[model samples]
Target: MTEAIVIAAQAGRALAEAARRAGLRPYVADLFGDADTLALAEAYRPLSGRFGSGPAAEATLAAVDGLAAAAGSPVGVVLGSGFEDVPGLVARIAERHRLIGAAAGTVAALKDPHGFAALCGRLGIPHPSVATDAPTDPGRWLLKRVGGSGGNHIRPAPRGTAPQGYYYQARVPGRPHALNFLADGLRIEVLAVTEQWCAPTPMLPYRYAGAVVGGASEASSLPAATWTVISDFIERIVAATGLRGLGSADFLVDGSDWWLTEINPRPGATLDILDRRTTPLLAAHVAACLGCMPALGAQPADAAAAQICYADREHAPVPDLPWPDHVRDRPRPGSVVRRDAPLCTVLAEGADRQAALARLETRTARLLAVLAAKKTHPEEAP
Candidate 1:
């Protein structure tokens, strides 16, 4: 059987599981192994062994090379979650193995906020207004790192931080909406739109909580606009970047208008919802990354509105498990109560958004404590 290379442990779990279920061999890269991964795929290499010291370059290269040889042909490299610094490295490594659909150069574009913002404008996509050096007419603008991969560190101008090398943008002022999409350059399949609300306070306190402070449910349409501008923008980006695999774009909605907030170049926090509403966007993402377009077509998630729920999110404060070593989305060690995969994902098939949400709320209350984290994640918006 043919094989694939997945660089992330937590982020790549669904993809790895889908691949194994489809009868393909999966070689995961990680620093260590865990019970969660035992049934999922094979671990090929530990990234730390490669990055810990510059002198270990030869050893690192050898380790990745052995993995390429083992996977054998048309390998697909998944960059994993929270990996923003090594697009060039990922490109070089994958290209050497003749891997298909590796968009290293395109991903590098994320580094330039001004250039990327201009490009988005040309494509007729809606991006929040921005200026790198504090525009003369600063309008609630924010200085952000184009290389921001995700999690905390994304917030309003919080005094002194990445002062010099930062990109600026007008913050979208409304509830956050994220769309999970699978694209193969030629086609883009939007699977789900998750609606999230933050607490009056930032989720946690200042970014140590491993979990989200408030609650999140799947949303169907922007309150007034229903996200048409944002939807068109994603299609434009797919055409522009030729980005393959699954990815997400976050936005802020003000009435009917939606403004782009950030981009996650890989599957992110919405995976659990997607897997519940749709048949794992990862399966199709992997296929697209391989240049293979499965016959699957796009559709709204589970009957107009799918109600996905989460409570007691883990904060980043807990010790981060070794990179590339992911357990199913479960409660962390300090978690007084154990949790299960998804906590609770309810599909209100054929029900209106309200009915679906009601059912979801009732179901989630039954399964989770809905307890806020003792600490908060810095990047979490209020």
Candidate 2:
């Protein structure tokens, strides 16, 4: 079997599973060596890094080299998240192995706040204003890390100067939505538009919660002109930046008015909800990177949702409960899970978006309840 290397903070499970679906043996290295990820991957290596902080370059390279040596002529590497902040590390990885996604320059350009804002302006796309220095009206702006994912790096802009590796972006109005698409350096094939919500805490108000696949009803609610604008923006940005393979463009949408947020230049969190097609998306992603846009299969008939189940309090050694089939990215039997850290992902499907999200809520609540009960009854098998 052909082998591929998968790396990310926590999203490696989704990518590793996708690689298996694509008929590739995946060798994975990530921050979290979840039980499901270990099962999906042929070989797994645990990275010594935290989420939001990019993986250490030397350690990541060593892990990749070890995995590559174990496989029988591996195909290449498919990065998920955590490398966006350090494009130089990405370039270094590409030097040692073939990269099956966006190039280093592309990542650097898109992750650069000033460069992306300028590109949006040049293309006549609506984007929130960005500045390196602190805004006069700090209340109207937000501070964001240069190449942050998962929204934990965002906060209300404070008065005075901006911190290093962070910039201020004018706050915009609207709900969070993302356009997941596959690009072949020039053209793009949109896969799905997902609606995202936040798992807010006092300190990290914008931390990502989950996403639901947009169903037919949700699609009909948006005006046709909104899609046209989105298409135009995608076409322009792909042509300008040479973005390749799986990518997601985030947007703030309210009625027909929309503002382009940042672009995640790799397979994003929505992959869990959106990668249900007959043709494996990883195959399409590899083909797209090779400059051939494969015919995308039809979207799943039912709406699906995936939500992260964060630990309410710290678990020094998590109880070995009977995890349901719908739960994914499961931690090992006796592992430490910090408060506010992701414990596992709960997935659900239904007739429509609302129904799917409702099922997700029920599943999440039940899982949390189970964990709490298990904590209280330490000897319980469940």
Candidate 3:
């Protein structure tokens, strides 16, 4: 029997790819088991309709059990995007299998805005102000879903009673950057410093657009002293939280000060951008969880980028647009996707960050145009 790794997440395609790159077979269970992800997995299960009004943990556990039965005890379980809203469920899953990432306690603490803000204060890490209630000055604070992933639930605070799972964060100004790293529960190794941006729709003002790896010309124009401070800050966080596996720290770079934004304590979207064929990141994540640290090299100078393309209007993917080789997580034909739903993930590499990002945007535009045109002329779709 082939030894497989179990991957459960909102979207398992990227994590599955990471597992495959690491030379491990994956048994995947996720909300969207896209065609590509299904093809890549040794076995697959869909976690649809398991959790409606309740926490998703039940469905998540069921998925893991199903996958494990087929794969005969996976190496470990890697939880991706979807579990932020239910960290307790993550803890429950960990009890059954060796989780290849942060523990439930670490996740619970870091995900709580109020608790994390307090942690920042205790560690002397610079962080923006946070509150449970909506701020009187909506313009100065942003409302965020406490454990939301990908920037979908963040918006300018509105004047009203705060939502059940929402909190207010003082809006900080500067270029948004994300730091990807690997930790061994106590020590950390920084991987890549990336530029994060958003593509707003009618509903999502900060829909996660994409990220460019090696974005800064030399990993930020900030001086060595500033980077040293950031490094120390990350080390302190690792020491305090005992975070393990692959994770990324979101930050707002204001001049020389790097304001910590949020911590994604799981393998994130940046996995695609920073993936090196020779050094699959999932391997490092697995190693880290098992008390081993992989020697991660310094961030490369070459620029690579990944963008999530969303449907502008209700339209099906064009059947004959000669879909580029760089796209992943592609939707099935004639699926009748709704507006603002993610269509696919586009990737590009260039000599510099600007060039790579421009290429990705152009490619995204071309794909969207094709989808729109195909919708207008159904006969031309094929």
Any idea what lDDT model 3 has? 0.82
Question: Residue 147: error of model 1 in Å?
Answer: 2.2
Predict model 2's lDDT versus the native: 0.86
Tens digits of per-residue lDDT, candidate 3, 193-298, equal 7788898877788889899875435445346686677777887888899999999888898787679988899999989988773568999899999999987655
Q: Could you estimate the TM-score for every candidate?
A: 0.68, 0.96, 0.93
| lDDT over C-alpha atoms for residue 373 of model 1 | 18
lDDT value, residue 55 of candidate 1: 48
The weakest ten consecutive residues by lDDT in model 3 span 49-58
The local lDDT score (0 to 100) that residue 92 gets in candidate 2 is 83
Name the runs in model 2 displaced over 4 angstroms.
2-10, 50-55, 216-218
Could you tell me the C-alpha RMSD of candidate 1 in Å?
A: 8.1
Which candidate's lDDT is highest?
A: 2
Which is the winner by TM-score between candidate 1 and candidate 2?
2
Per-residue lDDT tens digits for candidate 1, residues 94-153, read 666544333766666644567668777898777776675545544365556556543334
Looking at candidate 3, what is the lDDT of residue 4? 88
